[model samples]
Target chain A: MRTTKVLIVDDEVEFASTLSERLSLRKYDAKAVYCAEDAFAIARSNPPDVVLLDLKIPGMEGTEIGKIIKQFNPAIQIILLTGESENKIISENLGKDISDYIVKPVEIGELTKKIDNAMKEKEKLDHSKGQP
Target chain B: MRIWKKLMVGFGVYVTLAAIIGIFAYVELRTITKRFTVVEVADDITNIILEVRRFEKNFLLYKDDDTFQEIKKYLAVLTDDTDKIRKEIIKEVGTDNYEMMKNAIAEYDFQINILSKNFKLQKEFISKIGVLTRSIEKNLSGDVLNSFLIVRKYEKNLMIYRDKDIYATLINTLNSPKFATAEVNRYRSLINGLFKLYREEQSSIEKIRSKARNIQTFTEDLSKRERANITTILSRSAILLLFAVLTIIILGTAVNIKIANSIATPLKQLEGITKKIATADFSKRIDVRGKDELASLGTAFNQMQDQLQNTMRFLELANEKLRESRAQLVETEKLATLGRFSAGVAHEINNPLAIINEKAGLMKDYIDMSEDFPNKEKFNVMLNAIFDSVRRCSSITHRILGFARKTDITPEAINLNSLVNEVLKFLEKEILYKSIRLELELSEALPVIKSDKIQLQQVFLNIIKNAADAVEEGGLIRISTGIKNNTTFQVSVEDNGYGIPKEMLKNIFEPFFTTKEKGKGTGLGLSISYGIIKKLGGNILVKSEQNKGTTFTVEIPV
Candidate 1:
């Protein structure tokens, strides 16, 4: 079994770092970035298996960052995170390039479960595309 | 005066003047006619005198019995005419002149009678002389016969001419010696007497002629004077009639002009003011005078204008109030739209809450996994408290998001009274805690309406809860439901509580405008309720007085 690499992108530095540390403690390779530039730099330099993106950020929107990351690596799984529980935000970005989403004050167990499912989906796509 | 009366008065004046002129003309005509009658009578008298003179001349020239009878008949006619028209003649001439003319006519008639008698006596004397002369001629010689023939010739001349010289010659011949016999002397005396009678008749005829001349002169003078009087009367009547007509015309014109001005001037003023009124300038008023119809009309017009001005002022005030309300409505709608921003604000706030939650959960995770340490239990409890506080914050944020949420309307049949009761049941604990007396004046006549049941319940709950909150303990809160109007139903929640201050009442429905103490209200309750009612096609109104009470009425269209 391979370790799942998770990238956390949020304007809240403490929330991003603590969530990344929690995910690391749960035995997953996790990293945190505070802005879109750093997020894009880390995504291109070392692509993770799944990216956790906050919908609202300081500079660029989380969805725009997600689309740019997908352009860089089409196989990288993108998951949206939002503090807003509005169904509109979730429904708008659900089926398009993004794999899954979760509301904020993220539960560690539920986030791990969504990441594992996204990694499996990525593996399924990789195997079908003849990549081992 | 009134227009009609004024006109009637003017007409009366004109008619009276016309009548006066007519009467004056009629009287003048009668006077002229009488004058003409007097002149005719005078002329008839003159003609009778002329006829008498003609008969007198005939009698004197022919000495005929028929001529004398004609003279007497004419004299009688003159006398009768003078007598018949005596008063008229006296009126025309003086009484003394009329009497003198009558006496002259009588004297002329008497003289003619005496002349006729004298002529008859003279005729008898001539016949006696003829018989004497014929006897002398038979008994005397040639010389004496010649003298007697001469005396007879002289006597015949004296009788024919009635001259004094012929009478002297006849007397000398009758007294000649050849005629000295008693018969000759007697013939001489008879001839003398015949001559004397002829002279007397001549003098009488002269006297009658002079009397006839006097009658003719007096009658001619009377006729002339009567004619002059008629002419003067005619001229005077003409002047009087002209003056009366002129006076009537001038007076009638003046009166008519005054009446016309009295009527037309006011009418003209009314027309002018009416034109101004047509243009909506009600400032000017008719200057009314008198108790005429036009004055009353002006008063009525002024009253109508006053009413119109009042109505116009009322409309302007109403429009001002409407404008203010519209502005307030726009502000409320703007604040309602602020609910949309509440979603973003909630999202932003949730980030910090999420951070706190994660940090607390991370700390709890570390504490739960780590070995026992000093005050480890306290640290775990504090971390749990932080987590609980973050949860509370998230709940608040979710509530804010609910305001912005576009929830689907699930329309259902709703009975307002049952709904109100249901809402009251939810507030039962609060009501019990406050020991507030609740009175329900629910009407069964309320009809079931189709609306969003949950939203309507939220509106009523917000309003009733606000009512309960506004009151003190043991305060009375009355909840009543009824039909507000033909198309809407109302649920009024009245409370005997400390009412909102006047300044703050206007902003009560504004977003986040709340009088509640800190941490007790989010200030979104009433605003959210307003939004819901507005979406449900209803409205909420609040009436309050400081130290009195507050009433919140929610009206929903049925």
Candidate 2:
């Protein structure tokens, strides 16, 4: 079995780093960045199977970053991470390039489960495309 | 009395005085007329006396029948006139003088009669002597006849002139001895007799003249005295009449002035008060005096002024209330806007709180993994405290966002009693923990109103929860629900707690304004409930006294 690669994007550097380290301890390949530009650079150089994106960022919206990363690699799955529990963001971006969403103060176990699920979903799509 | 009655009374008095003056004038005029009549009678008496005196003088000179008749007629006229005005003459000239004048006129008339009888006897003696003298002349001649003729001529001269010398010559001629006959002697005797008769008649005429003069003097004096009396009476009546007229005028004017002042003084006061009322000053009152119409009008005016003052005060109070409510509405709007802005800020703050929470969780995880770490339990405890603080921060942010979010109302029929009971049910545990007395005075007849039930429950829960929290141990909290008015229903929560200070009362509805100790309150309960009530088309009001209690009332339209 291959380890799942997860990218974490957040304006809060400590939150992103701590969450990434926790995911790394849980046996998932995880990286963390503080801005949309670093997130874009990491996505282009070495893309992850799943991305954890904070909705509010410094320059670009997390949704916009999710769309741009999806364009770069269609197999990469996006999960939105936000401090807001309102359903407006989820309903707006749920079926578009986003796999799922979670509110912040992210639990390490829940995040890993979501990342594993996104990787599986990407593998399912890639398998179907390879066969076709 | 009424004003008109007073004027009528004054008029009545004036009429009475005028009548008195008229009567006085009439009596004075009558007295003056009587005096004039007396004076006329006096004048007539004086004229009659003068006419009698003129006739007496004519009779004395001529000794003729016509003159005697004129004197008698004038004396009768004087006697009649004196009798007609007898009382007036007596009043003026005394009774004794009037009677004396009457006697003098009688004496003059008697003497005229005696003189006329003596004149008749002389006429008879003259005729007899003429016959006797002619016989003697025929019987004698020469010297005797010449003497006889001379005697006759002397007799004729004596009769015509009535002189003493002629009488002496006749007597000498008749006494001559040339005719020594018996008939001649008779003629000489007749001449002596005629002389005696003429002497008596002269004495009577003198007595009549003195009497006529006395009567004339008496009548003239009487006339003068009566005229003076008439003049005195006229002047006195004029003075009395003038006094009467002046008294009437002065009295009438005084009465008129008194009545006019009685009426005009109140009217003047009314005018002054009316002017003050026009200026919108209603502080002054009318001093009502009499029971007259003007006094009653003043009383009514005072009542009107009182009403006006009360109405003005009421309007001022209403205006002040309107201004305060308008300012409150503006504050609510500002708070709403602030609430929206704070929601965004709350969301922004949540990000950092999430970071801090994650970091604390990470530290705790590392400490748990390190079995031999120094003071690892203390480190875990500190991290747990940070985690708790983060949890508190997140809860506050969530509440801020809830307050700013647009609420979707699910309108349904709600019983206010049941709603209050439900809120109290939520606060029951806190109430039991504090040993606070919970009193419910819910009205059974409360009508079911159409409102958002969840929002109303949140509002009631917040208010009643505050009441429970505010009270001391075993203190009282009372929840009551009732219909406030025709269009709204009310629910009130009262607690005997340390009430909010007066200075802090205005800011109680502001977000994050709390009197509770740090960490004991998030301060968003009442503000969020206020926003909910406002959104539900209702009002929340609070009343508090320091150290006494606080009561919060929520009024929602039916």
Fnat values, one per model, are 0.61, 0.48
Winning model by DockQ:
1
The sequence of per-residue lDDT tens digits that candidate 2 reaches over residues B115-171 is 778877887888887788778778878877777777778888887787889998776
RMSD of each: 10.3, 10.0
lDDT of candidates 1 onward, in order: 0.82, 0.82
Residue by residue across B507-545, what tens digits does model 1's lDDT show?
987766889886567677787888777766578888999
Using TM-score as the measure, the top candidate is 2
**What DockQ, between 0 and 1, does each candidate earn?**
0.41, 0.35
Residue B153 of candidate 1: its Cα lDDT?
77
The segments of candidate 2 whose C-alpha lies over 4 angstroms from its true place after superposition are A1-132, B1-41, B65-232, B245-249, B267-280, B286-315, B337-341, B359-379, B404-418, B428-436, B443-459, B470-476, B481-492, B495-517, B526-558
Q: TM-score of each model's B chain?
A: 0.59, 0.61
Once model 1 is optimally superposed onto the true structure by TM-score, how far is the C-alpha of residue B496 displaced, in angstroms? 2.7
Candidate 2 displacement at residue B356 in angstroms = 2.9
Which residue pairs clash in candidate 2?
Answer: none
